[model samples]
Target: MGLGDFADKAKDAVNSDKGEEVSDNAFDKGSDKLNDATGGKFEDQIDKGKDAADDHVGNE
Candidate 1:
């Protein structure tokens, strides 16, 4: 209904197991595309950032 409520629901969804799987898959696919376009120049760095995000979400 409200912005806060919407944000809360989104946060809850993203913190769920299914949501994590979906998020990781999406991020990996996108990262792969970017890495391909850049000839793998930033793949490792991209992975590190994604991993950090996953760690933060998992901790929550």
Candidate 2:
């Protein structure tokens, strides 16, 4: 498949219930890791970024 087709499929998958769950878990883990690595120094920024990402992927 072409890049556009792949992207469309990916978008569809991410809009599914299972995909939203998976995406939420991944975002939580990744944000937690970043917070830990930075000693929570940038927790606010990281959370904002995480929220934006979740919204972009239609998680909520």
Candidate 3:
């Protein structure tokens, strides 16, 4: 992996102790806000993008 990817993995490890539920909730809240702001026009894409991000960030 590149240096940035390594750094991100390290950060994820450190924050993993916070527990998965916390991470999931935070992402859900952010997604909700984005959907609300956009009037649900991009709801599906936003949800999918959020899921992908959460997966990458070690939330799932």
Q: Give residue 6's lDDT in candidate 3 (0 to 100).
A: 98
Tell me the tens digit of each residue's lDDT in model 1 across 7-46: 9999899888888888878777877888899899998998
Question: Between 2 and 3, whose TM-score is larger?
Answer: 2
lDDT of each: 0.81, 0.92, 0.82
Model 2: lDDT equals 0.92
Per-residue alpha-carbon lDDT of candidate 3 for residues 2-56, written as tens digits (9 for 90 to 100):
9999988877764685746677788899999999999999999999999887776
- Best-to-worst ranking by lDDT: 2, 3, 1
Cα lDDT tens digits for candidate 2, 1-60: 999999989888888899999999999999999999999999999999999999888544
Candidate 3, overall lDDT?
0.82
In angstroms, give how far residue 28 of model 1 lies from its true place: 0.7
lDDT score, residue 34, model 2? 100
Model 3 misplacement above 4 A: 1-17
Flag the better candidate by lDDT, 1 or 3.
Answer: 3
Best by lDDT: 2
Indicate which candidate wins on TM-score: 2
Give the per-residue Cα lDDT of candidate 2 at 54.
Answer: 90
